[model samples]
Target: MTGWLLAAVALAVGFWSYGWQGGVLALSVIVFWLLLQFSRAMRAMRRASESPVGRLRNAVMFQSRLKRGMTMLQIVGQTRSLGQRRPELGDDVWTWTDDGGVGVTLHFERGQLARWTLDRPADGPAEAPVDAPPAPAAPPPAA
Candidate 1:
């Protein structure tokens, strides 16, 4: 859509320039616009393929925050479903936008409890505490 709009504008300018020069100027403008669109699309495709993990991480973080907000609703009991829904099950995700304009969706099951946190990545390994104390021994049972 954007490409078409750009092409239309370029074509108009080229047609206007044709009176002074010739059809060559118009043709050049059209070619330039086409090349620009092609390059923009290629760059977008490259970015999409380069860092899929990073993209997934960002989405997880966004959804995690949304889940936290839904937790406050007090839905009771565990969730019956979660995650992206299948076509057969119908769409079961709710979306909201954060202050920064990032959109997030929290997927949930029918009766399950769902929660999100804005800490680390959902798949990232947790770091253990350096000065963790040993477990305490249980007291003897009544004799």
Candidate 2:
């Protein structure tokens, strides 16, 4: 309502000062700016709808925060992709960016959790599901 009132006032003033031609030009400029703003908003919404991008729930964001010594299963259960890019999961390193924009990095050694960190990359990767093989069996006992 306020914006409309302001625009009306501007239109009236433009006509009084410079006649119809100038008034219409001024109004066109205002309309152009509004259109630009609308376009940007729609674009942002469309992108978000396509993928899990932009703002997210706090709990969902924390799922990426890995604790030292967490199993691969536990880590995967926590970290999730924040946007188009998903968390990259590997036997050696697991990387992801949470909704809050914080990076969750988990490094493993021989199927054991080695390190956990937070480092957002320029381009984050999608979350990788963990499917680690069972631990190796112990050697047979001597005769």
For each predicted model, how many residue pairs clash, with residues at least 3 apart or on different chains?
Answer: 11, 6
Query: Please, what is the TM-score per model?
Result: 0.34, 0.37
Against the reference, the lDDT scores of all candidates come to: 0.45, 0.59
Off by over 4 Å in 1: 1-17, 53-55, 60-143
Q: lDDT tens digits, residues 1-143, model 1?
A: 66678766766776686664645676677788678867865655555445422223343354533433344133111121223323453344444333333434444555332533232334546656889887689999999
Query: What TM-score does model 1 achieve against the real structure?
Result: 0.34
Model 2 Cα lDDT, one tens digit per residue, 1-143: 66788888888888999999879987997898789867865655554455453233343355445466766544433332222223355547655554556655557777667876555556757755588676799999999
Each candidate: RMSD: 14.1, 17.3
lDDT of 2: 0.59
Please give the lDDT score at residue 83 for candidate 2: 28
Q: Please list the residue runs of candidate 2 whose C-alpha ends up more than 4 Å from where it truly belongs after superposition.
A: 52-143
Write out the backbone clash pairs for model 2. Answer: 86-125, 86-126, 86-127, 87-125, 87-126, 87-127
